[model samples]
Target: MQFNVHIGAGAVLASALAAVGVWHAYSSGWLTPAKPRAGLAINERPPEFIPTNGGVLTIAWVKAYETFEKRSPSELELKVPLGTVKVPLPFGETVSEVRTAAKYQYQVRLQKRWPIQCGDTQCVVRTGPVELAEPVAIYHGETERKTRSGWARFDKAANLEQLNRSLGLALVVRGNEPRNRDVGMREGRVEIEKFVREWMAKEAHGARRIVVLYPGEQMVDGRPVPAH
Candidate 1:
């Protein structure tokens, strides 16, 4: 077709072409993946793509925090010593009786070891079966005796908030979330499985695609995709 076009039509065509180019740039993984919170980098890899709200104390805690139990094959998850668990100290309302029990020492252990590059060749590796993460103990926090009713009321208000927090998700395009840095895999394929699992767990009434947008651009699995 060799039809001559007017200047107005030419302008519209140019604009349309530009828009198409932009759309492709967005989808071809041209844009960088979001950066996760800092200090959370495992084995020097920054994995910011995790969208979960870190359901640490939620139903998924069993899953999210279960790395300690599983045998990881990389430095993505650290086998750290001295992980803390809050233990409620029970005592009387008055301070006299509680003072006697405060002096005793309590021990807790945290363990999880992952694989890593050992040397020049594939020689770098864990020698035998997965080694256990180190265990260490620290003094528990100061004991306080609030009434069972007092704690019940506080937990009623606080625990319910935790229930809702599990439903929330975060798109950390920049910065760090050092607390869970260990969850990110270096050069590892994106955690699409986690995303899909979480989406399925929700009650979606109806939706064709679970699209996410970055900086006003629609994203397909965090990579920009064509919107229409």
Candidate 2:
């Protein structure tokens, strides 16, 4: 018996092989995927985009200060280091301005003789609310820049007033750290997670997405979709 092979059979086989080769190239990173098209579906006027405000949260390293005791005129004062603190921000609030609120350390030094009732004869010296240098911007993201100073004057139009009353989210200051890798820093993170978990439990606001913004690489529980 003579078998008849169609001429298109060879062409079909070649087409199948070409498709497989293209797929292999894609799998092997030799081929890059096309970028998604931006804009509205169908005939659109101005693109109407609703801001979901998916709870944009930011954590920032605030100010650090030192305390010391000035003894006599000849005696030098010993300074004690105060670790850096993380100041929280109001939820859904975009900071329009950042200004520092002054907090000062005062020391009373002995000037003239006092009565026996006063244990230490000292002049009650009133010092300044000495302003510290502005904190250097660490995480340079859009939200990070706005929230850098920790204390922010949120935009009035952000509708924070309504959100604040509904959300009941307040900026909380946790532990103090001398540096990012400080032992207290880890402890602070733990505490922050605990706080977040507790806060989540209290919310009956249905399912919501939590997006954490960090400076460097982080180990997430599952495979994370890269934002970049």
Cα lDDT computed for each candidate against the true fold: 0.28, 0.31
Tens digit per residue, CA lDDT, model 2, 1-228: 999967788899999999999999999999988754531123333311222234322222343322111111112223434567545333332323222221211111211321111012111111112122222222212221112111242344343333333221111111122332233333334443343444445643223332221233222442222234
Top lDDT prediction, candidate number:
2
Candidate 1 per-residue lDDT over residues 78-170, each given as its tens digit? 233455854444321211111101111111121133122222111111112111111211123442222122321223334334333322222
Candidate 2 overall Cα lDDT vs. reference? 0.31
Write down the TM-score of every candidate: 0.15, 0.24
Model 2 stretches with alpha carbons more than 4 Å out? 1-11, 23-29, 32-181, 204-214, 220-228
Clash count, one per candidate: 10, 0
Where model 1 places Cα greater than 4 Å from the true spot, the runs are 1-63, 66-176, 187-228
lDDT of 2 at 51: 24
